[model samples]
Target: MASNFAAPMKVIAAAFEESTGHRVRLAFGSSGKIFAQVSNGAPFDIFLSADQAKPHALLNAGLAEPGSAFTYAIGRLVLWSPVTGRVSDGPGALREGGYRKLALANPRLAPYGAAAVQVLGSLELVETTRSRWVQGENISQAFQFVATGNAELGFVALSQVMKEGRIARGSGWVVPSSMHRPIRQDAVLLEQGAENPAARALLAFLRSPRSAALIESHGYQLPVSEE
Candidate 1:
């Protein structure tokens, strides 16, 4: 959850730890990558993915409990840049700048990347920035590319920069949901994780009101409770 779920997870973990004194560790990566790791018998108790596909893969592979998978949040796309003077107020900013490199996670692996492509297509900016594009293996790496200035700007999860209901002091545009599909981030308990109580605690806390508030503070829409 740390890429799509990164900011929200941090905020929620703080409240969870403060209230229960139990720590939750974060491992951020593309759902595909993490799912692959978990399938190989990795000791991960809980998985929060940028899409439902990875969790579905886990279910198919007999690695995750079928009944336990649930959506945690909705991810939004952003056109973000680390440049001092370049400002992005919409998806059109890609064409309006002097940027030579824009990074994104692999669309085939990360839902955020798919949203980025959809935004570019909607704005007709994909061809303009195609040659200058940088692809990260995953969403976390894509964010890092822009964050560290390795790429002038990148499509990243809003969850990365928004915390406590405020955006960080960097120029970017939050793409409307009409621009792309909703990033229905899904979570599941792994068979490898059933032995770990921390994972269960983490999942329960994620659904609690306190954690829901923290997730919203980081720019992700709070999940509708599962019936």
Candidate 2:
């Protein structure tokens, strides 16, 4: 699973277990790193990626079951800080650049990081902000940097700091989707789990209306049809 899915997946997994009596063990990381692990023969039963590319690549490599890929959630990126009002002005605050440190995930490793880079590029601030960069291995760690005050603010998945359609704490600016390519997160059944009933069942449950509501409550958009 993508690190961004960490919060919602815990609740979703528990609900699935309670209703179906099936256990689920999840692994979370940058989509790039997870792709490397799965390609190297990790015993994971499914792959929930932060972007569609990795899952499609797995399908091409025969590592995942063909036709099993589907968008599970549309992720939203946020400029956030645990300090209240730090990012209330959104891109303007970024432009002001009074802060010493700006955290983001490694663009090469995480999709959210890539999206952050896109926003910076769009605003013509990449070179201006380069010197203040504090890159994390994944979005989860990038968020931790801000939450711990190591960085003044960061670009993180909205799901990390949101609940019930609102910011749960601190402040964040939800980056407009037009600022970057859509972050269509996709999930796929791995070849190793082709016959695993629990794996199949869990995938079905992820697409259920109950799971859809839980996902949306955590600040994600459902696919158009699901919405």
Candidate 3:
């Protein structure tokens, strides 16, 4: 659904294909975009959303089977800067300091972006940092803004920054979940004949213990899911 899901899901999907000999094709994008596609008849058999809202929309629209959707992960946000070995410890840094361009995902579309807004507001940086704010369509793009130095720094997903089994390269702060609402990312099995053998295999394999373990290893927390 965002940068956070990309690497972890890639590793797990590859391993699943290796073990089960069941190949999987992936579709990745902003949760909002995916949701729109799914609603308008995207060919995908399953929807893994960045937040619960989109999947719930699918379920409510009868695009997904009742009770077939559930929270798959809990996302965490981060404050990342591209500079190597530099870390932005916390929200306070954004406030009592100066940065010309700061990036964040569009809060209206991305839950992590919304949380970043909350963290800033809680720290009283909204009014101070508002003028400096720049928006990405998704968290990955937001991370890219900071990663490529397009912006001085930005709010990103913790999972995206995790590299070589580490959280981030540059100076950044892993925002505590308590600072914002839980990002309950959900996955739904589509009801529009998406229940083909391949789809079932993919779904089953995603919830497999090995897959869950791998995703967790990449710094994403798997939900107590019944998917």
- Tens-place lDDT per residue, model 2, 78-163, is 99989888887889888997899999999988888999999999999999999998999999999999999999989999999997
Model 1 error, position 193 (Å): 2.9
* Per-model TM values vs. the true structure: 0.89, 0.97, 0.92
Prediction 1 TM-score vs. true: 0.89
What are the lDDT figures for the candidates, one per model? 0.78, 0.93, 0.80
Stretches of candidate 3 exceeding 4 Å from the true structure: 1-3, 224-227
Task: Summing lDDT over every window of 10 consecutive residues in candidate 3, give the lowest-scoring window.
Answer: 84-93
Q: Which residue pairs come into collision in candidate 3?
A: 86-170, 86-171, 87-171, 87-172, 88-171, 88-172
Best by TM-score: 2
1-227 per-residue lDDT for model 3 (tens digits): 44569888888778878877877778888988888888888887878888888888888898987887767678878888878544545766686566788899999988988988998888878888998899999998898888888888898888877876676477778888788888888888887646587667777777777777777676677776432
Q: Give the best candidate by lDDT.
A: 2
